[model samples]
Target: MTKPSLQILAVTLCFALPAGAASLSDPFATEAVTPPRPSPQAAGRSAGVPCAREIPAAPLTAIDAVDLTLCNNPQTREIWAAARYQAAQVGVAQAAWLPNLDGRLGSSRLWSEQRNYNSTSAALTLSWLVFDSGARSASGESARQLLAAAVATQDATVQSLFLSALQSFYTAQAARAAVASTTEAERAAREGFSAAESRYEVGIATPADRLLAQTALSQATLNRIRVEGEARNALGALASVMGFRAGQPIELAAPPAGQPDAAFAQDVAALIAEAEARRPDLKAAEAQVRAAEAGVDLARAQGRPTITVSAAPTWAEVDRVSANGGVVGVTVNLPLFTGFDTTYRVRAAEAQVDLRAAQRDSLRNQVALDVWRAYQSLTTATQSLRTTLDLVASAEQSERVALGRYKAGVGNVLDLLTAQSALAAARLQRIQAALDWYVFRATLAQAVGALDYSLLEPAAQGRP
Candidate 1:
């Protein structure tokens, strides 16, 4: 109720309320937005944005599969949370530039032989660091660089998941194609069996020929069954990767049907250079090096001098007598000695810088090698596509001719069965080659840090 008490109460209500409100409101809270991409080209690929999303009941395309996996998979969420945590650290670093305030209140009672009295006191203190030899700046820079690293790491993780979804989708498609090939082989074998039975009934084919045709039909049927099972297993694996139960059913649209683009034959050296420049993992490593450099600066600054300003106001009411006072001062601190702790800290921070630099260089080399390997794989897959196309065509023709010859009684059943088997094998090879082409194309894009929805366009090589 006194003047000093009123003043202390006013300051407490004024400054303390805002600080309390800030604590409750969370000024550093991040929005539930999509993780930032390393490049603008990836913006169109709307994956990894956590929201209420449902997988389409209809068949999924390659792009759909990737989007679902990124949105639903835990890997993306974990990396995103890490980046957000780093963002909060940036806020913490920025806070070092601001002033701090504290308030204290105390009450005590005394009882003696001849006197009894109650005492009450209140005080408010404010401190602001005016200079710290650039320590705050160095700390803020380190935190910001770490945040950059975290963001780039998130982009790298998203690209990895994108490639994984593509690989699984393509594998499932290949398995389905294999099943179709086996079914066709089974049909061809059945036709051959029918022809053999007809020939044996008319005394034009031996019992051995009839027996061989029946055996070939049964083998084809068995292969068809096995391929169907494989296709189912492949679908289950894909479902699991998409954050669904392993047994969940997922229908996939017919894959793109064309061979990979010839433009992928670009110079390998140029591609490697592009990857080093654009790869998110490389960027992340480079950021870590810069952060380590900032850490060295922070360590050195910690051993320097600091200048701070402080203010305190006090109020007291004891034995019905009130008093008020205020104090303001500036202080300087010089770290003259710390048992050689600063010396070791500076050395450790400098060593960390060296370690980060070496790691960054190592990662840069790995990026180049990754691009080279992916390029070579895609090239090999492309060449195999041509051979597989020719192989399937020739095998189909041979099987037809052999079947015609056997039906006309000019060839043994052995020739017909062998040709049919060759055609079946050729079909499987073609399917596998197509799958490899799709996978390698995506792999090359991922290696170059450009995996996105554009790669899955209808006109791109993703079809088939």
Candidate 2:
């Protein structure tokens, strides 16, 4: 009989619970089934690299790789995350337009020698804001502008990070080429030394000549090893930037092998103009100024009036006794002197507007400076590439002449070794110049606000 009575009471209580709360089961009664966490090794990525979901068909060259494929890159994901967070901001601002709703419900039964009673009650109330001197509207607009700025900031960061990754990858490639060139030169020198030693043993070449060949070979070999180590470090740096797995392959697609296009505009003036109009960084900053202005309006509106309506209903039962009642009305809150606080706030808000405007103006000048500096780097890189190309061409010709002379027995071994070293240096300088041009152009692109990444390219093969 007691168990049946308890069951009856439980059923009554479940039916009388609030609409939303009725569905809320006893959380403590349910055993939580948690998903297995990923292994630590599998979860950590490089400090800043994005995870690329799919490896590309071919190796991705610096200029051809995706900006930030987050499969392996966390930084890329971080930039994109701002847009997602802004969604919450939208919800917060829009909340003002919706009516606030609240509710309560309860049920109980009791029987005693002196009394027997059962009671049930439920209430739903809604409150809506009627006026606030446009404060709500201003606040909503400010939130909207801030959301836009966040999106813009994310875009700008994405562009900058991807461009940086691309450049770092290119630098590593050039370093690899430099190491290869020096290694080959060392091998050639060692072979020449072997030949000279053989000739000296046969009394056909002087001991001085053999010694000179040995010295050159030793120096070349040492240089090769050092440069190869440098290349390895460069690869490591690039791997760090990619945020890929330690042993993961990072193939690069070959970039277009043409020289940079002809100079678009002469100097910093044109570049500054372009940045002011197009740069995402500056655009985001300007948005802050607008948001701040709205903030000032909001603070001033606090000195005015606000209208709201509130309603509440409640019920109580004890020993089978019960009572239920509710109240509903509108409220108008008026501002009065409270230590001249509102007056001070108004003054502060006006000063903040002035500060924001000044900051905006200052940033405009700073942006111009950035554009000018990047533009200058691009110009210098162009000139350097031209000079390095000429140097490489001359070294190639000289290496050919030395090789021919050595074969014909007219040139001393020292001349051949010297020419070989010069050719190696020239080749490395040319590659470095090309890499500089590539990176600096990307920088200039970012500064001038033209940094749209084409997601079409995939990472190429053979990079690990």
Candidate 3:
């Protein structure tokens, strides 16, 4: 081949190869590439909190547990990632407003009989849709609304995780209190059994009385065992919610004194109103409705005419002769028919709008129900707290009297056992009431979108 022909072929070959191809090889050759694994440091960073080698020495409060859960839980990170993805979608929507530029390169070698011909061309094209009947604007608006909804949903997820951690903390505390109460009962039973054996040895009590006292002691021991198991289970649950491994040892501090009456002073009506205005899930639903409405506009615009401007500058080499040219045009495209595809799309978009509207209304009703239920629960727990305290006081006095009577040969073993059991039950009831009060208080705050770390803090009691 002549020098000019050779130079033309070399230039064409340079542009013809794929951008990332290796030198002196076909551009489209297949090669398997292994995906890279994350380094140890990167993996650790993404794995959240590291597992503890030893038990936590300090007592954890509800606030501390919530903070740990937010920092270490995978669910919280998943929500954050989703929000970031929506942000990227917003950027993509914005890019639709700008023009697009694309580059193209081509080469071909043809042979017929005994002669060879070569051609190569390169072009730079710019295309801008100058008018689209507001389709791009509607799409951008829809994406922005969806992004807002994603952010609201992420906030709701955080609130949910914190509530779970708080409830688990309260449950663990209640279980521990039950174990203590049961231990006290067991001690009381052991003393009663010893008294019954002494009385029988002196011929003052029958063998049956000793047997009854032994049975009571056995029952108390069994109850203590059961309660201790429950306490361990509760601790495991707390650890799981706090983003720790199962069976990890964790000590919990006593819950702060809470003011149930003061917290419940706000009426259900006001709470419902607050929930409607502040609840993140409800806000997300409203945003979804707006997004669906924008989608309807976009679907309608899709069937209309679009006006676009296009231009291209071209260079070509044929038979070693270089040539250049340019082309410009304005085009209008109208969809005449698409087998009813556009018609169905618009209908689908309209139905989605209706669906979103229904969802928003449904969420509003649910928020109101949540507030009402939480308010009622708080009131019932508050009342039970007072009643349980009275019951405990009475049960304690009764146990003391029965034990003294038995010691003086006036009361039977059955009376002492009954009194002891009642005292234990009363104490457990008091613990349960307190736990319920705290749980309902937190639930009400969550319903009103006011649940935060502050709710777990120590506050002045409205009643002692």
Candidate 4:
């Protein structure tokens, strides 16, 4: 009889337990399985479209590249997302100024001394913070400043992306020019080799001359191969920056023919001043400083008094006897102590303000340095461009004379080869100098916070 009674008591206790109580069979329960979804490419195919297909094969220009990058690049999208998230934070801060309402319902059963009783209750409450020593106002201001910073950050990202696309586009163009130059050199080498062979067969040129010409041809061929590879690599880089897969086919328009912008020739000090005034990063830093200052104010305000008003309306039932009641009250809460937590928080916020100010100063110094460096680089490239143009003309004239004399048996193969090599080198230098000038111009624009897709357009059209 005792064993039966104990068993019955255990069974009663198990049934009385709440639904949320742990069960012995929990670890043995079968896990829920989720069905796998199709991959993105497969899903696209199912939707009657393909992923990673080539875009319309238009002649891509620097401006087109910039547009593509801004549209497709993940960095730009990521920054935009961040800006949206910060905007949401601003909304959250604003919500604190509004009233809050809550509703709750509860049921209970009590058993004592073999007697049972049941009760049910429901409540609807409203709370409105009438005052908090300007804490809400400071918080809202801080959120607004943060949102401004995020917008500035997005602007800075756009400029940086434009500069990157510009570099890749110009690099691809330079590589293409290099391939053309090498092809010209190879043609000249082939002509020289043919002349040497014909002269040797006629007993006018020695075997050494033929060998020298052959060696020149080989060198030119090798240079062409190397430059062709470089051209391919540069194209791949351009495609990547334009937010396409590497090795995507893209035909680029010829770069515009123009000197560096007159703006780049301005005084470095003036450039620095412009950068300080216009740089998006600097603006973002200033906004951060403002936000940090607001944070300090918010922290200090936390130690002050808060005033709130609340109302509650409730319904209750016990053993089928029901009653309705309501409450309305006003309260004041003064934070007299919190183990010095508020004091520490205020100090930390003040330190953060100082840190942001320091960062802004540091960024200003960096901007000045960037302007100085870009100014020097642009000047050097401009000078080199003029010198290389002269050098190419002189080398070409010398090569023609040497080739003519060799064909007439008056000049040696060595002199002809020498002139050919000089012309090739001069051509390559001219191409590199032109590219450098363009790249440095973009760099200077970026340093002055003037880099934009409009700036990449043809200078003859108008400067942005």
Candidate 5:
């Protein structure tokens, strides 16, 4: 009857809020979230330093190499994009807290006996989940925690690529050093052969001496050739990691001409604690555990009662006659039974929380072990550097004395060659020790989550 219709119209008009009442800000926007930080070198260039995408004309330094790798590497872009995806999920969860408004329109024509009529209707409905236990809050919290995990994962990936860049750069430098050492050995061998030839021509040296010196020269030449190839291979590897073609030329700046310092000497227990606190991967695992916990709350809330308020206003026209009416209602939904879906969901969410906690604990132990191994390796490398320096010095003196005695006809060619061989081996060991020390230092810094621009500073003055 008209009375009931009029009552419905009155309630609709009372609840039909103005569209202008809605919040102005977009609920789905993610601009508030911060992205991962770019490389410090590239950021520094914004102040005054010139930055170019192309390879620099000058030789590349370790810092420059890391910057290029971070800027051009596909992994960096992939990780940050994933973080942005998680950020979007956060926005989606946030949007759930706001009300929803829907509009509908319909037109229909009816024919009966000898009569036809058309009716058109339009309606606007507004629904607000005034209460849903704590489902909305729990979902939002879970989304935020997952976003934090994503950002932390991004940081961990960046650190990994940084360490890889350092490793490749150091390897290239070591290879070049090997080439230089071999070249010097070849020159020494040639000088010895010339000395032996001169002595033999003057009837002061045996034929065997001349032949031995020639054989030594050949071996030195072969070593130089082999190391030259290795140097090129190392450079190619460095270039590849920097997002360049493998065969591309990449000249590296000379390595620091000094022994590594003991600046890394610290208590292992303290270092492990620092790593546990600072490591981004570990932080990410913690966030995952928190997010899983939030999921459990959300699942439990889903099974509880939900209260929603809805209002709809309608306008209709039939046979040139108009009518205005609407209905306003509140819906309370309580899941009495759903084939035990909610029960299983809550159980699954709880299990997920436990799983994540276990994973986090496992990663914590691995982090401690990583710090310990890196610390020990660095310590061993440092000691080796000092010992190799002394070995090279003694071998050099022995070679000089043997060569001098042989040239003066007071020593045999065998002694001279032996001393020179020892010097060559010692030089190689010295190069290896330096490479190990630098690499292990970077590894330790990575394990501690402290690898950054400060570690890329030029070498200090000291013996290598």
Candidate 6:
């Protein structure tokens, strides 16, 4: 009787089990436990990517394409070329310390009586700055400073060009992403339209629903077309920046993968410090200050004595005749005070020094402000990228659920369409967020006035 009662109880428990319970002969339970879906990316992709890098891009190397474009740009090249010329001027100023030699050759014929003489003269005049106080020395120093400033200006030009190139590269890549995004949206919309038509045929969905889906499909298709066109334009712009013809293929070289992360928290201050240390423009201003000091010295030296020596020798020769004569002399002009010319020049030089010093201080403040702003931008972009990535993941999961529901006839056409639209928006947002982080990183580099050559590709090297 006890065994029979236990068997009846076991049978009763088995019969009372819910149909969908995990333990009750459920085949789909294992399938439902499958892993989470992947994030919307070119299979095996990750978040906050510095930029989508291709193998073709790796060959560009940091030095080749970028360096050459900045250095070799016909318009930009002039800045460096002019810098060379300014440096040469330093040599000219140094020349004052050396003697000058002039050679002359001439023949003169006279028609007057005994006093008139036919003559030919050949001579060299030599003059050296024996002393003009410190004017020569001051001028030489000023010229050297000017050359340094010019070189700094050239550096700034190169930096500016590289920043522009980076902008173009990122812009084109963004457009590329946009085209892909829009194309997928169009495909999703068409699928939605098809789904809507099938539902309407079964008398479940309204005709208006099918029409709405079709309209969305048309709009998505148009948007894709526009985005594709924009991609072409962006590519052209990138090519042009590379010193290539518009419409040329701008092979984007992958920069070393950088991500906007909390790593910036501690490093942002350091970046600001780098801007001060590495920025060439600051050095240029400092050079001007030194140049101004030299100018002051130059002015103060005005009344000082400057000794110059000159000599000329002459002779008369007849082509077929006999008599000849010659004369030789040395001349020197000592500085004579002319209404205190030196004193006024000294005053002017003092004024210039004050003005230039003020300008240098102002520039320093401006640079500091720029550094601060760039740091903030980098931080903000980094945060935004993280948020967008999370959103994409959520949207992807939602999209999968919707797909499953619609196929099972439990979800309506509207649910499927909305889910698809949301997924597209999420994907695009993520793409844009990734691009923003990269662009802000480039901006941060530019603000600091220094660039890591290692991060650049080979295609960017060699401006000369």
Q: Using lDDT as the measure, which candidate wins?
A: 5
Cα lDDT listed for each candidate: 0.83, 0.67, 0.79, 0.80, 0.84, 0.66
Compose the digit string of candidate 6's lDDT tens values, residues 1-464: 13443354345445444346454334214223221221112112223233222223444432344544553456465775577567656756755665554556778777656566666655434444466768899998898888788777766766776667667777777788888888988887887788778878897778887887888799889989998999899877766766767765555544445443434434566766777788888888889989999999988776666665443333335543543333333444456766878788888889989988999889888788887887787677678788887888898788778767765668876777778788888888877877677666666766788644423433322110
Superposed by TM-score, candidate 1 places the C-alpha of residue 77 at a distance from the truth, in angstroms, of: 1.7
**Model 3 clash pairs?**
none
Superposition error at 58 for model 5 (Å): 1.2
**Candidate 3 structure quality by residue, lDDT tens digits, 1-464:** 23443354455446544566534332322221111121112222233444443446799877667766766677866776777667667656756765666779999997889888899998777677889999999998998898789878877877788779878989999999999999999999999999899899999999999999999999999999999999999999888877778798798987665434544455678788988999999999999999999999999899999999876777899878888876789999989988898899999999999999999999999999998998898888888998997899999999999999999999899999999999999999999998898788888888888776556444523211
Off by over 4 Å in 5: 1-29, 41-51, 108-113, 196-211, 458-464
Candidate 6 overall Cα lDDT vs. reference? 0.66
- Write one digit per residue (lDDT tens) for candidate 1, span 1-464: 34764575466446533242335445434332224523223436544544325667898888778877877777877887898788878777767776778889999998899999999998878777889999999998998889889989988888888888999999999999999899999999999999999999999999999999999999999999999999999998888777677777788998755556646647788888888889999999999999999999999999999999887878899998998887889999999998898899999999999999999999999999888888898888888988998999999999999999988989889999999999999999999988888888999999988887878775655421
Model 4: worst 10 consecutive residues (lDDT sum): 28-37
Using alpha carbons, what is the TM-score of model 2?
A: 0.76
Candidate 1 lDDT: 0.83
Q: Residues 1-464, candidate 2: write the lDDT tens digits.
A: 13443354355445433343212442211112111111111222223344345545567655334433323467655655655556456556655754566666767776789987787666656566778888888887787777667766765766666666767777878787787788888887887788678778877779998999899899888998999788777766666666654435656555455665535457578778878998777777788888888888888888888898765555556555566656678989888765788788878877877887788789888888877887787788788888987898898899778867766677777788788889888888888887777677777777777754422122211000
> Which runs of model 3 end up more than 4 angstroms from their true locations?
1-56, 257-263, 460-464
Return model 4's CA RMSD, one decimal: 12.6
Native RMSD of candidate 2 (Å): 9.5
Q: lDDT: which is higher, 2 or 3?
A: 3
List ranges where model 6 is wrong by over 4 Å.
1-68, 112-117, 251-262, 265-267, 317-344, 406-409, 412-415, 456-464
What's the residue-level lDDT of 140 in candidate 4?
88
